[model samples]
Target: MSHDPSGHPAHLGRPGHSGHPGRPARIADVAALAGVSIGTASKALNDTGQLRTETRARVKAAAEQLGFVGDARARALSSGRSYTVGMVTTDSFGRFTMPVLLGAEDALSAGEVMVLVADTRDDHVREAHYLRSLVSRGVDGIIVTGRSADARPPIEVPVPVPVVYALTPSTSDADVSVTLDDAAGAAAAATHVLGLGRRRVAVVTGPVTARSAELRAAGARSVLGDRMTGEPLFGDWSERWGRRAVDQLDRTHGRVDAVVCGNDQIARGVCDRLRETGRSVPADVAVTGYDDWDVVALASRPPLTTVDMRLDELGRIAGRSLLELVAGGRPASTAVTPTLVVRESTAGA
Candidate 1:
């Protein structure tokens, strides 16, 4: 009998074999079971080419019945793709990367694509090594991401391949990036506070040097205008900073009716300090936060009214962009607009 490379009888993998005998099911067996040509079986299995829906379904059901799985090498040869994607991130903590990665996976999994994550921890050497490895493995595409919204240098790849940035944008305008519209989100928060008749608004946010901070402050400023109480209080992105900013606002801009915080942590801190100082939220001061981080926002004394950055949607768009690029289409950079989630903090006001 003819033998396979593994010294097994080749008949075990031949047509009409159910794979029950010491060997895995092959496409030939699936084609025989489905009563279709090998070519049609391949097209149906790979989800390529136009075919009658019922015919494809029958082929898939037959393959499933036989527990057939196509070989990676053969699939790659037929489709000219490894069916693998790589996600490289500097955010080892996964604070921002996780959501984006999950969203990208959601989009890619539909096409049977697999994602390989490489956490560089902001290390250039490690990132370069990961890039080289991914390229060598012949990944179909790559997605680059980071912890912050700042623009970073484009990742260098020796061979031309599709690369998309998520959350963190690439410095080169030519590269496709999907990111949050921080300014618009902050503006929405400010508008909501204003609509509640809280005119004396104060802004507390992250470092003045941060692009997100700058954009958020600008967005709030554009709306608050002369009604804004003093200038924005820029500090670190922390609860301590938030509490301190509240104290500062009390001393410098007393009796502010509302505060727009940089993040959920800051907003929670502001709420705590406000209560300690005997100020009732919504009644005395309405607070709004950026980044609707569930751990902080939902657990706050009065769940924060915050901007939902829609990070998952951003990642999904980034994934779609990479797919388009891989298909030889030039997809434009996308800026996902944030949505405001109203909760007890602002609902009472």
Candidate 2:
């Protein structure tokens, strides 16, 4: 018969086997079978207390033998933590929030903590209600996330637990936050375009009042220096704006070699306009975009060389930071690094 390294028969803890027959095993059963008290069994399972290694091993063996699936409540009580986090976001169903939420969920779930998510829809009253509900349920901590990279007012929660912000940064320097580096993303796209031997690059993007648009325009200018074709064309974040900018650039600039857009949607419109104007992508005007939002980038003609926001990684870091804060560690604000996702759009010019 095969045995575990501990000299216990391997079959003892295998599935379809239980120390007590015909009933689900409980912590009490594990304790009774191991000749330890219920408290001791819990501490052993939780890796707490002053129990000897052999005694802890005995408890573990008993738990496996009884097939005891631990109760989260019992585990939480012993550890003085609920093993749960409240994920509150204002940008529900938006592309940005979804990735951050999923990333945070990934980290929390792996650490044996459950996530309870709620959308505030930018409603302060509703947000207050949800915050109270989460605290009342005894969540160990909370993660507040939203749609923009711009700093916003701090969430006021009376609870004595850590709060981590993602996507939308907290204006307060004291709070831990994980946010995107939009300038870096834009600069990366510019660097790639410049590398393709395309000078006289034109900028097309969202409204100048928007933080993202301003940052991206500044970043592109920073990289291109005097090589910039003209002033950035600011418009709404839409394909129509991209299309209109094409006509404007053609009429004014006369001979543009490249275009760097704020988002994939604009990039697609830019490519469409080039094709309509009998200009081949890469050959006529090398194009680049930001946000590597796959749907638009992949479907574009000849595809687009874009900058990936890497927001999933940002979310993961935010999740880890919340976990650390709950465990009494200090995690500082983090800026996610953006990388280039090269394709045929900027192949050459």
**Candidate closest to the true structure, highest lDDT:** 1
For candidate 2, the per-residue lDDT at 36 reads: 82
lDDT of every predicted structure (CA atoms): 0.89, 0.86
Question: What does candidate 2's lDDT look like per residue over 50-148, in tens digits?
Answer: 999999999998887767888778667766789899999888848988888888888888998889998999999999999999888789999999888
The weakest ten consecutive residues by lDDT in model 1 span: 5-14
lDDT of 1 by residue, 1-349 (tens): 4344352423333444465666678887777767789999988998989999998998898887767877997768667899899999999838777889998999888777889999998999999999999999899999999999999999998798899999999999999999999999999999999999988999999999999999999999999998799999999889888888889998999889999988888999999899889998878899999999999999987889999998888888888888889889999998999999999888967
The estimated TM-scores of all candidates read: 0.87, 0.88
Q: Note each model's CA RMSD in angstroms.
A: 4.4, 4.8
| TM-score of candidate 2 relative to the true fold | 0.88
Model 1 CA deviation exceeding 4 Å by range: 1-22, 28-64
